[model samples]
Target: MKFKIEFSGHENIRSNHQKTIEITKESHLTPQGDCIVGVNANHACADLPQDLKEKLKNPDSKITFSIDVGEHNFTIEGKGHPDLILTHDEDIVIRKSDFVCPRTLAVKCDKASDLLPREMVSMLQDPKTKGTFTITVD
Candidate 1:
């Protein structure tokens, strides 16, 4: 099977952030069941001031967005935070929901440490990092 990844968010946030993503299938029967979505504004917005970059690097930092595939739409709020010290190119996996099958999805925030608070790390590591709610069919 084939799948597509889509992202929707504030114009400023979506255009000024960097994200690395990945997807893997959990079921053996569906070899093509998984799909990956990676996005980043690290080098793209390099001209921005240092302070702006710092704000975008926070692990606790979040970008309100939505993901859509087929007839299913998933709303993700407050994403981009991670408990672990993710490297520049690390993949932050996203948890599966009713709209999507059991697949591992990952996302990495480029230079997120500079923006992320140390205390917030632990909270972002959970499988459900984002307080996502299904807006459409699950």
Candidate 2:
């Protein structure tokens, strides 16, 4: 099977001062599994605000990132994990059931909308939230 992933929007909500990184779709991919594991390679270092840069750079600091991956609207939090481990980051993979089926046959992201703040009890409740983007499996 194969799936196409699309990232819509993301925000960093560690301190009261909220920092965000809006990314347009760079590319999409489909892996053999029902879901594919995607690691934000630059999640730890890039697209961060200057004020938060140093703290995020700390190897001991727990830095988590949220992204709307190709309609699978979900956030992956990095907890006690190094930003560079090529395999460890692959632990969480987004799969088909994560999204509303049939309606969203292909995944896509807005890059301008879709923001999930930390205060929210559920990331899935955000209004800017669009249902998980879908992909074809074959």
Candidate 3:
């Protein structure tokens, strides 16, 4: 599938930087049954506040990111997983929670149950839904 993640606004929560960045999705799904998407953080690292990046690396962080698919906006929040890592190529890890039923879909994210609505996850499970999606970071 082909998709783009748009990062706009200033670096930190507050800044006047007018830079906007777009990163393409490398692939989906991880070895441990998770949905993985990443972009080189360096592309917009200069605009981002240092603290936000630190928070992203912290397992206890409560930061939430949004993924917009057509009119539906699904959310993915931070999971305090020890394996979760945020570096130059920021990998957004979506894990399957206990709420998700067993499935054969390769597009499912393990951490997504708590982050995304069940119905949205169901829609994504459909192979027809693959192709283009957007991750908006503001």
Highest TM-score: give the candidate number. 3
C-alpha lDDT of candidate 3 relative to the true structure: 0.33
| Winner on lDDT (2 vs 3) | 3
Task: Report clash pairs, candidate 2.
Answer: 3-30, 6-70, 71-132, 71-133
Which prediction has the highest lDDT against the true structure?
3
> What's the candidate order when arranged by decreasing lDDT?
3, 1, 2
The runs of at least 3 residues in candidate 3 whose Cα sits more than 4 Å from the true structure, single-residue gaps closed, are 1-4, 7-49, 80-85, 88-90, 96-138
lDDT of 2 at 118: 37
> For each candidate, what TM-score against the reference?
0.25, 0.25, 0.36
| Model 2 agreement with the true structure over 1-138: per-residue lDDT tens digits | 212333322232111212222222222332221122222223222232433433432345443334443233434332221232212211222212213121111112221122344333133223233223222221
Q: List model 3 lDDT by residue over 1-138, tens digit each.
A: 122444221111111112111222233333233232222222322233445444433445444445554456655443333333333243333333312111111112223333444444455444344322332222
- Compared with the true structure, model 2 gives a TM-score of 0.25
Regions of model 2 farther than 4 Å from truth: 1-6, 9-24, 32-45, 66-138
